[model samples]
Target: MTDYQKQSPMQAIEVNNIKKSYENKYALGQPDSKEGISFSVSQGELFGIIGPDGAGKTSLFRILTTLILPDSGTASVDGLDIIKDYKEIRNRVGYMPGKFSLYPDLSVEENLKFFASVFQTTIQENYYLIKDIYQQIEPFKDRKAGALSGGMKQKLALSCALIHKPSVLFLDEPTTGVDPVSRKEFWEMLKRLKNQGITILVSTPYMDEARLCDRIALIKEGKFIGIDTPENITAGFNKTLWSVQSNKMFKLLTDLRSHPFIDSCFAFGETHHITLKNNDLTINNLCRWLQQKGHEEIIIQEIKASIEDCYMQLAQNG
Candidate 1:
């Protein structure tokens, strides 16, 4: 038995064989919306589910939040059964959906107060829990939620989610549309919240953000590709990755991918990330080959593997 199974009862969240589907009936070849998904989040741990837009992240979140039920499986939130104790689970957890779901016409303060009322709590009662986020948007408390900038709206939504002092928080792509600065600020807030002992389950499509989590599960096409700490995940990538650039970037990508010795090639920032199929692949040989192919200003160097690289590897293998 693994550590997870031995401590299953102590986890803040537990999901076992959770499966869901949107098909009305057996369509000979339709895939289940989500299949055989399972994972656990420990108390006060910042666990992240990283994947692309259609990778069943929202489905998993909806199931865990009790807003939607899985077709088959068992799950628990904060030690309470998700199905049998949904009411209690709802009270003990907070949820922030991807889209701005707050009342558009209501002012920021009004929205916060309304959510507090739903939980039979007041903003003043849990003011300390969300002080940092609330302070940033308190200056415009009277502004309509829809009128606030993307980042401010995000803060307001988070403030409202924490009004009841829930033990576990679920944020689904909370920084999807926010600016880079706000994205950084939001992560900082999460780090602080984790220190306050709130177990957080956050999902994001950004690979860079995966590094911020204590541990991350990479999901793709309705299944998990890999799960581990960011450092471990990247370090486990057993490949010779290189960052290559040339005057003809498009041609460089095309040519490298087609090369017999290259395993994979994809554009990454200003350069293309290349993986060699053979262990003997070298930068000097690659540059010389590209030069012979009419490429100019060719630059090639071995680069450290990143979470994105690991994710791609998992996707390919699975």
Candidate 2:
């Protein structure tokens, strides 16, 4: 409590050994997550938690936003203790939950005003805070929140979340169901907000979006397999990858897995991405084998490792 920010302005959020369990199936952390969760977010930094559904992202967000308490461990938001200063933490941080929790009956403008009023603030006072995002949806201000398009609703939710001008913002899968264009626009808004010195922690299931963050943590089953800049994580992949396609694609996965040199193989879109046990292996060796198996129009080429590829390797190891 000795002027935390003044002492360490770079550290905006700190979480240590946080753990939560549900008595029923709706639990955040399953038995495997008993080791606890730990991570830190820097001030004004764009941090991302990348993972698929049921990865315990929502549970982690709920615990940080103070909507639900962790069974154990500790965390601080903007230097205030999550447990002892839940109220202060709530007021100082903006949280857009994965689900739409806004009022359906209220008009878009009405909902924004309601959220602003909750903190004894007004839309006018925070107009500059969310101006860029709000202007996109202002034309439909009178439309009922329930009737808005998916993209528009996300914009409004973001506006409401920013109306209070929080120092730290937590967005849980803000682009989950949004269209490609909306997702692009949303990340642009986050960059502008980051420039204004607001720390952001966003979660997304899209691996493509991982590169947009300053730093990211690749999460799976309530645990982090790797945490680093996107470039670093992919760069660490020291394996020879190949993209392969053939006329008989149905059995391609089984055939590739059967290959003695194949270290790993997974179907990706229309092609199978595989890595080799020996980097010295040649493509002709694979081509001749497929030809003997009666496969036609076989195409194989080397490719670079992507964030998804890195994740696949980690998840497979465990």
Candidate 3:
């Protein structure tokens, strides 16, 4: 087994009851925001914070990276207190914000140089750390950053973040707005980085990406609803799940919602996922009911719950 699979008790990152809030009128204006969100990342583990937009993923990243102070609670990275060891925390962590913050006018090589100089280091001194990712865009080193494609820009941003050889890397929604192929490539690069013993903490709005992390914390409205490995999370889903489809999807959702057996029904891709109060509801009965409601071409099947299903269930319960 690899070091990440060992499941040691030693924590590389510890967050204790952290809280933050914006003004009263803001979208995240809850008076008791964050309400003690806490979790830890093991050394060399690929940890993910999975949530939709406005779930406070970015706020938590900012707090952990020491870019912003929390209203209350304490956090430590590599055993260095965030408040007391702010500068040290900055040195030990590489943070790529949600938005691309690199200078658009500068070339890829220049951006790398700027970040390296800011950390008082040389790219050659730590070239090995970022070489695998940087080399893909190296041929365009002299091209302006703004001129690169979305995938290339992501690579450049990640390269700049890692030039200083940080022990922990925090990426906020790194895969957003990229093509599906680019998203796959980005996660592959993360796996390579994880193999090199770097603790990675990433946040993404995409639920499918949760499976890629060694472990994930599902967040919503500034609170963590669940935290565990992907397999465990999906296995822990106790409800009876069914995929219900009909020629009239819109009417199917409405009819299922009013069904006596259904506990919850939500759209999942092309079908509506229905959770029954009990497993006794059979497809024969469901098809007959849909037919009686003037529905045609109805289909129903028992299915396993996915990470997205678990996330939605947790969100509803919370």
TM-score of each: 0.94, 0.94, 0.94
Q: What residue pairs clash in candidate 1, if any at all?
A: none
Per-residue accuracy of model 3 over 83-129 as CA lDDT, tens digit each? 99999999989999999899999999999999999999999999998
Clash number for candidate 2? 0
lDDT of 3: 0.90
In angstroms, the error of model 1 at 54 is 0.2
Q: State, as a TM-score between 0 and 1, how close model 2 is to the true structure.
A: 0.94
> On lDDT, who's better, 1 or 3?
3
Preferred candidate (TM-score higher): 1 or 2: 1
Which 10 consecutive positions of candidate 3 have the poorest summed lDDT?
A: 24-33
State how far residue 226 of model 2 sits from its true place (Å).
0.4
Candidate 3: misplaced stretches above 4 Å? 1-7, 25-35
Cα lDDT for residue 279, model 1?
Answer: 77
Model 1 segments beyond 4 Å from truth? 1-9, 24-35
Summarize candidate 1's per-residue lDDT along 127-232 as a digit string, tens digits: 9999999999999999999999999999999998999999999999999989999999999999999999999999999999999998899998778888878887
Model 1: how far residue 265 lies from native, Å:
0.7
Candidate lDDT scores, in order, read 0.90, 0.90, 0.90
Please state the error at residue 138 of candidate 1 in Å.
Answer: 0.5
